[model samples]
Target: MSTADSLAKVIATLDWDGDLGPASLAVDEAEQLRSRLGDGATRWVAGAVEQSLTALHGQIHDSLAPWPIIRTFTRHVLTATLLRLADQDRLPVDTGAIDRDLAEDIVARGIPLSDITQALRSMQREWLSLLIDAALGVRPDGIGVVPALATSVTGTMDAWIGAATDAIVEERRRVYLAEQVRIRSAIELLVTAEPVDVEAVTQLLRIPLIGWHLSCAIGVPPGGTVERRVLDGLVHLFARVVGSERMLRYETSAGTVHLWVTTDRPARTPRVEDLRVPAPLLVGIGEPHPGPDGFRRTFLEASDALRLAGSLGDNGGVSYGDAALAIVLSRDEERARWFVEHELRDLATDSPEMADLRNTLRTFFDTRMRIAPAAERLFLHRNTLINRLDRIQAVLGHGVAERPAETQAALVLAELFTRRPEDPSTGRHEFGA
Candidate 1:
């Protein structure tokens, strides 16, 4: 650590001109590498990494591959900053903290050395592949380039930079793909994965085990890549279980997919509510799971969306996440009361006939406002309706006279009673509707 050596290191760092060559050695290596390596791609991965920085604000990266690299780097740097703040119990970066000196601070402080280092090592290969696949955008799964269908700037995804540790993106891809397949296959089998089907999944998808009754889930892209295969394969099985109902599968982790399933028939998407969930994870297909907000979407929403699509038969897709609170946890007596009280405001109360009406209302709303020849087709009397009405109004109070409020209140209750809280693992009993 001589002063001249330190000065040389500083100058060399400043130059970023060449590796192993003296600070003065200027090589056309970058351009040559770009020409030699990019396959006519716009940017070279090596140059991208060499020049990458973790800024306080957002970056100015190109729209493809290396974007993940920049994003991952940016996130880790930001994370390191936050962690530092957390350690010192002070807020270092915030809306105003993009102080421009954070980089120097990180370099000086060696922030999050172990974490950033490990993440970078792990993410290396993915970053390199990103140079190729970001532009490809999942279309590669379909034979040749497939003519790069009118791609749009839908959103961005990032892989934490692993190149910093001298690892490449390819290696990380192996790790990322293996983990992703494991999760996807697990969820696939957990819900509908059969024992016989397990072997094929293991061989094809490389997932190892299929546990029973676990509320596991996996990230799914909106359309392309693996999502199509996963959802399309499940369609037939879903069709058997609930004819004419919609199905949906949201990645619930990424911003890339706002996957939506729509149709003109019956459907069901389990509204997200706090419930026991398997270990939550994030992957590259979409966005990083923003935690519970990310995991909030349940297989139920995807199911409902698919069912609806089948009904009207209009094809649809699954979607994304910015984090969502699962409403299932709120389906308790308080929330049920709160929903009615808020929506109905004046329509929440208890009366016997109202109790019966409540039952009918729950059925009607849960059935999506269709209580017609079905209810009457069972053969009821006009007085039956009249009595139900009287009790409903009696319990709901003066606001029940207000058609809008009354309708909304009844709807919330109906939906409330329909939460799927039947996790045998938690010993919570099923709600017998």
Candidate 2:
């Protein structure tokens, strides 16, 4: 046969299937070469895996693929490639299952596909070189067959790479879906008042259950979306503020995030003014509380505070301490309104005159009913303040001092429920300011 015909024959007879049975003279010859290599083939695979690992390390600083996983995958690829060459027929390597498993793990770890492909390419080079050297060592006259063997090696490696690409995409979709389900289940369990296995939940969510937790409810404007980078930035900020290394977060479909920063010891509540929240984002923070029960309590508090902030059109952070009364009173809106109207009477109206009277009353209560300080704070003459107080008393048909606690509580509830339009330029409610 001519040289071209001889090359064609070699290529045609080369087995792509991994069958070990004798199919032709070429198969017998290839099998003899593999048998002669013996432990040398094993050594080649090991060497190739090491080389590939080294290459990967140089390129990727943080790959989620563990040492054992990488080694196992590399060995399978090399072993299957070698088997195909020995069989000298079409060797269909079964790397689909392994690829899918590995791809899912890598995707979950957030490792880029480029890193995986780079490692695979490194292994391909090492395996090809080793196989060629082995072939020449066993048969010095096999130089002419080198092209056909190299073609087979490249073809098999390329197929593996294609399969891996598809696996990576599929695995990414699977991981995203699985993660959503896991987070939803965890949130439900943690928020409910039902008895729970704290240990099991901690393991499932991978967060500390018995530490000091400072919960925060972070919200963007309605219909907004929170990107991954934004969430990461928020986590870093919260961790730094609370001096905690551990944190747990869950993002809702409406672009709200519930985050908990945990520490071993008590942590100070982050100051609202110090938060420096940006525009279009509002944050509600719960006080630091300890243990599993505290976790649920703090989360509830933060969520309540967040709703209050949103309703009040607050543009910045609001702590539970700041919104505690509003949150509590707003819980029973009907009862709260009745209490406020009953206590304040005519002063409970949203009229400007009533608002002024309520402010004066609030100032009076704040100053311990000291007329001098209350008058000064309200910027009113002493007699003017006294007259307003008399008017307030007449509206209630009693003395303000007669029901100080109830009057004060009623004033707070009235202020909380008063409907006020948000400032156009500042995006803040008058009460918030």
Best candidate per lDDT, number?
2
lDDT of 2 by residue, 28-100 (tens): 3335435633444434445555666666677667644576665666656665666555553333454363655
Candidate 2: where are CA atoms >4 Å away? 1-4, 8-142, 161-180, 223-232, 422-433
In model 1, where is the ten-residue run with the lowest total lDDT? 148-157
Give the number of the best model, judged by TM-score.
2
- Evaluate candidate 2 by giving its C-alpha RMSD to the native, one decimal: 8.4
| TM-score against native, each model | 0.25, 0.70
**Candidate 2: residue 279 lDDT (0-100):** 65
Q: lDDT for model 2, on a 0 to 1 scale?
A: 0.70
Model 1, CA-based lDDT? 0.33
**Cα lDDT tens digits for candidate 1, 178-279:** 767665554444334234454554354332222111011233323324445544444333333333332233343332222222223323332222211111
